[model samples]
Target: MAQPTTSLLCTGLSFEWPDGRPVLDGFHLAVGPGRTGLIGLNGAGKSTLLRLLAGELTPTSGAVKAAGEIGYLPQGLTLDTGLRVDEALGVRAAREALHAIESGSTDQRHFDAVGDDWDVEERARALLDRLGLHRLGLDRTTGELSGGEAVLLRLATLLLRRPDVLLLDEPTNNLDRAARERLYETVAGWGGVMVIVSHDRELLQHVDQIAELRDGQVTWYGGNFTEYERTVAAQQETAERLLRNAESDVQRQKRDLAEARMRLDRSASYGRKRSVTRNDPHIVAGKLKRQGQETAGRLQGMHTERLEEAKRKLTAAEEAVRDDAEIRIDLPRTAVPAGRTVLSLDKVRLPHGITADLELRGPERIALVGRNGAGKSTLLRTIAGELAPLRGEVVVPVPLRHLPQRLDLLDDKLTVVGNVKLFAPGAGDNAVRARLARFLFRGGRADQPAGTLSGGERFRATLAALLLADPPPQLLLLDEPTNNLDLASVRQLTQALAAYQGALIVASHDVPFLRGLGVTRWLELDGELRAVDPM
Candidate 1:
């Protein structure tokens, strides 16, 4: 048998919101050494349970037993990072500072009094190299760094502390392929127990085990994303079968009850008519009473069947999906234009701001491939006209729509509907809600604050606003559109994009999404203008 992880254990855990409805009811899970993926739809109590496990939030009814040191890397935690590159990486200096604090502050007093002499320089250098940050220099502040850079630095600091357990939330939300793969390698090699909550299917592929949270409970399955996927599909099929059976049973019972009531009604009326005529009164009354008993029995049976069928339906429906989004319907759409030049770029040099510039044109679907600082964002900016080229002008004939990798353009304080309306006005509430529903952000979700939405949810809202706009743009410039979308939502999005007749400029490292979208054109922005056929 595999050894159970010693540090973390939760038994019969339950947590309730202010309304007293349990979000986590009798949740049971065990955390052990090696990397594990926590899979669930957003708001399925995954984050809430994580917080309770990390000691950040207390469970309302049950206990969380954590016997080891814990370090938490929250989702999109780059906002509060005031550390320089060296400090963020916690190079040798932070470790030395720990030693100094242990050695009665002599080293600290010396380092504080004489700057780098207090061993800060040596410590910083060592940690920076260990984390591949020495190349970035120690003076760089995390606040101004790119999303990937900031996240990497944050991860390095968390690892430097070498806590016994690690809890990461959406660690690869905004990372490029190279960055995401690099993180996978790090997590695979880390020595402590790790619980990673992510909607990224690719990232989950690296996990040792997958624990799915649903219906206020946790179920663990051995293996990686592949196994988890198979399990979920099997559950869905079973749930569907149960639902069908339940519905059929309910309908049969209802029909039988209706027929029985008719018979009972006729028998009583006949008895009443006989009594009025003064004919066989005793026999007729006796028959009516017996008929009533049979009718009551039939009614009781009907009620029992109805209740059982209802329970089955409820369980089946819940098991089929963690939420209502699982119910898929046929989509309706209009036609698309047929133009040769969906998007064209002539002798266009991508701005050499972070890395390089390039001249490129997208045939059908194009992938913007590169590392974190390799100029994907810069190129997108140039194409979007957010950044003016230093030399040649790029031509964009098709109406272009871009959902930047970052939600920087979004007003954080606005409601979800408000954000969508900002991009597209004059749309009716029902129309806007329909768009949100297409993106799986419907119901009361429209009233949610953009800032409070999960990374995946925010990405969906942004795309919904852009794609649902009147006269859909012929050229779609997507910078990591799959960054935070859930599995079901991603599938829906993939289908929608696949059916689109316009051109696609996708700057993403998600090979699966690109493959599913049938990307034909491939471009790499290294330092100059060039293209490649990734066949």
Candidate 2:
């Protein structure tokens, strides 16, 4: 069978937020059948582009054209808790109509609704199971599912539509290892045009091409993210070389200009001496001096123009080199002694009846991996004392802090500094401001209300508050820390965590990120918490 031809094209696309902040300006792109990974720094309009393609958002000044139907799965999906699994899957009416017809109701409306999807219920269930939602029934309410489960459920609904163009933004944000593989498989087998905006390195590796969005434009690269990196590395090298050459030219031009001026001065001085010695006519002397001055002015103008042109070229070269800033901080007080016990859980059972028996000492880093709703977040909350375990006890011998997946620890009404002050009450205003600056919130940025900050900024503020608590935390618990973060924010977070000398327990599905953390233990939480290979 021949696969359907798919195409998504946008021309002269321009979009601005309600507040008049420009995100994309005159951007143009055409994507055909294949997997295209959309990547860029946070706030580069990757999500905006996806939204425009999906028709969820209208472009300010351009058009989006697609060869067929479009399906989009947005980031931070929140399904209606009142909706049933079948309704969420978009098959409730079809299933109901099918059942009605089977009962001998020959209503044409029923048949119309049923259309060609007689097995809609079966297909819905099959896709749900394929995404690791086997235990969830069609009649189950959305409230009964976890956040990650809801994300997968939404994706299942899209797959059931079988649209010719698919847009998935951070699809694997809350998924586990098994679920991620399932998603990877879906992408690999997809024949239609698909655009995915994700920071997941493994997911990007499955893409056929890479489209990088930067400065309100999209640049296409011929291969996957690894190839994109190699190409970017080479581009950066060339840019740096050009910048060096431009700088050298500018310096040479400056020197030559200075020498010309000196020579002009000497010529004028010698001319004056000769004129006086020969006692030449005043008119002839003046004319000669006028010609000399004009010649000198021309020479200076040429050298100056060359130097200015070189500087402009240097500026352009510098622009080509990305200047991604890194987050750097030192938490010396957060360190733990080699023999100090940071955390201990003795037969601790969470509200979901998930049990854990664990111990950590020194600066040990542990990764908590499990499927959605398998009680990973519950376990972390239990360890953080935010929830009481049903059976046993959790002992924290050192001061600790927990960064929840939703980053709800912050008070939206308060400014970033105000929130930090609530955590570190003893610290002075200047001190708190200084620390916040280290977290990339400098000066006035620390005064922004928590509710107004972007996702990445809010995460940074929340982390700053936690780390700068009165008694420095020795054990840090982070739950899906990379959820809504862009690739740059992810790297910033990774670098920030790298400087912490404390023991850490991070519950996340990001395998690449976990590997970068120097994790000493890997724990998978299903019904119990036990050590496992990184895998």
Candidate 3:
């Protein structure tokens, strides 16, 4: 393949954690002017690579070269809550300078500070308005903004800079459907060299190409996310075919070796019988026997060598196949009868002016849709008994469990097995381990401290703990469960939920995921809960 022009380039890059765990080693990449979607499983160094490109973290070795100034919107963006909107956008000085000049101060320092940005306030407001943050005035503090709003505000700051290269990590993590759409549009219209690390499939669809980071290497694929998936699927099919052929070859070689040994044994028996029957001379017989033995050794060695080579080829073929494990488990105890009422809300008034009055029966799967700050999470929390409704009541007749967006349900100090055991005290270690294995936490993985796991691993651990609870929850509530999850992790979550035969209410902006769950009811929470058509 022809190399792309180097708008942004990194060569011989290497980095490691303080404890000497390697992440990127001698990694190299060159990206030209266009939008590129950087994708990989959690802990595959996507965020770390962005940090390196943005100059937040220094590489242990090698260098990064960019055509011009770089702008970065990190995954975990934390602005000082006390800062004003203008200050956060990095235009406070220019705005102050413009204000001084307007008041008739002709100081050269003011002109220098203002530079050519005489209309800084206007430009900032325009950018904010474009990003759906017009409600937030320049005087407003960042603390007043919601998480999704904060993300947009950060993007606005980057857009104002007009950097030559833009790098965004998980830009739509906390965004609701509307906010995510805004981001997707921005990504699609981006004109500079942009690299975005995100699991949001819709956002990825806007990219010109997909760059997958895996096993300390980068693989490039042309076109959008859908194209990438198609290419990968075809590659996997070929790999699987080669693996099967290799396995068959190994089996054939084994059979051939066994047959060769049997033939040699038969020849030795015949030679001994013929020598006794013919009464050949002792010296001649001895010489002939030695020659036969030497020939047999050579034949045996050749078959053994062939078998070993076939086995080696099989091993190599196996390595080529992908092994993205899926969650497989039976949750018969979690099943709810069709006529049973699992949960109900009566005139429930949650924070943010959300009022919901609804009843959930049987194994109804609900997709809760709304814009950011619309109290979707509040409703879920109230149903899970984590928050008290301002007015009215929430009644959950069956056992319930909630997987919050932050996935804070697991104790950081405890191991995965310990956390599950915490929820199921009556269950033995063996039982818990067996169940955890289905969640892809087998043996030593289950013993790892919860604090030491990656984003995907942490989600799985939390989910396992909740699903394997002593009573086996029949009503499951998930608040933005797909947030921060990679594509593979999202697939694992979907697989696990497929086996859940219970009432499920998932408040997520991930329409594809909700649709995959076979959502029976679509509810929109915009001040009032009402049924809506499937999105």
Candidate 4:
């Protein structure tokens, strides 16, 4: 394959956290011009690699080499709340200096400050418009923007710079459909070397290739994420086949070794009888016995060694296959009868004035889709009894639970078991742990502090706590549950939800995920609740 001209290379890169947690060791990568999607499990060092590339973190060893300037948009961006849009774009001073010179100020300093980029403000606005932030004014403070808007603003800032290499981490986490579409368009138009670390399937489909970071190494796959998936599936199938073949070979070798030993034993007995019948000398008979035993031992050793080699090959083949455990549990208490009315919203007006009136029956799975700040979250919160409706009432006929987007339902200082116990106070410690294990927090993992867990682990812990609560919630409401989760984590979540036999309302822009849930109803919330086709 021909490599692209522009390249970003890392050689023998190594990094360790302050706590002595080694993330990458002797890592190497060479990314060239084109859009590349970087994916892996939550703790696979995708984010850390990006930070290293962007110079946010220094590698313990080795170096990063880039042909030109690099720009990075981190997963979580914290901008000064007081920073103006133009300031966030890094053009505030240049715009002011240009204006000062144009207004007849004879200050040569203004020209020096403005330089040749006198149209910086125009370019910044154009970038913002391209990112769906056209209505936002340059002087508007960051605090005035929504979470999605702030992310887009930062992206716009990056775009305005036109860096030779661009890196984005979970750029679509907080974006709504419209904002996500704009981002997709921007990605499509990018011509330079771009590396995006995201689990958003739609966004990943726009990439030229995929780089999977697993076990501290990078594996390149040509084409987009879909192609990567197909290739990986085929590879896994082949690995599995080889593993089965190796297992069969080992068994055959073991059987052959045993049969050879048995035959050798019978042959030695026959030889002893023949020597005795022929009245051979005692020394000659003893020599013949020793030689026969030695020959049998040599052949047996060879068979045994072959068996060991086959076992080793099987182990290696097994390592090539990924075993991402799925969450499978029987939540009998969570099941609702088909005719039961699980929840009802009667003229429920959200705090933001968006009225929602609806009724959920049985185990209905509903997908809530809308633009950012459309009150989808607020409505879900009201249904969960976490927020008070401005007008009307919410009727939840059964026990319910809400998993918010931030996943802040657990106490950070408490252990996973302690958190689960808080919800299932009546359950014994052993029972709580046994139930937690079903959610993938087995044994010592249940004793881990919530604060020490990674994003995916914390989410799972929170989920376990909620699902194991007393009475077993019959109505589950989740708000953007897949946000910031890796692909494996997303799969785990989907598997867990698949076993949930209850009414579910998930407010997420992840259409692919919702579709996987077989959502029975689709509701779009702009300013009010309106039912739409599932498509």
TM-scores of the candidates in the order shown: 0.79, 0.90, 0.92, 0.91
- lDDT tens string, model 1, 1-535? 1133546889988877543545677777778788889877666766667788888777887788866778888764655557666656555455456566667776545456445444556655665555455566666667666677677777877765668888888788667666777788788787678898887777788888998776667788889999988987898788777777777776777676677777767877876786677765687777867877787677767766776777677676656654446322222332334435554455556545333433334337787777666777877887888887676657777567777877666687887888888777888888878767766666877877786666666776777667666656667889877765567667767887776767778887777777888887777766753577673
Candidate 2 lDDT, 185-233, residue by residue in tens: 9888888899999988888999999999888788999889999999999
| Candidate 3's TM-score | 0.92
User: Candidate 1, which ten residues in sequence have the lowest lDDT sum?
Assistant: 326-335
Q: What is the C-alpha lDDT of each candidate?
A: 0.70, 0.88, 0.88, 0.87
- In angstroms, the error of model 2 at 375 is 1.4
Q: After superposing candidate 4 on the true structure, give the runs of residues whose Cα lies further than 4 Å from its correct spot.
A: 1-6, 65-67, 78-82, 410-422, 425-429, 443-452
What value does the lDDT take at residue 22 in candidate 4?
81
Instruction: Write candidate 4's Cα lDDT for 89-201 as tens digits.
Output: 88888889988988999898899899889788888888888888988899888877766888899888887777889999999987998999999998988898999999898
User: Between candidates 1 and 4, which one is better according to lDDT?
Assistant: 4
Better of 2 and 4 by TM-score: 4
Candidate 3 lDDT over residue span 299-325, tens digit each: 999999999999998898888898877
Error of 1 at 317 (Å): 6.1
Superposed by TM-score, candidate 1 places the C-alpha of residue 478 at a distance from the truth, in angstroms, of: 1.1
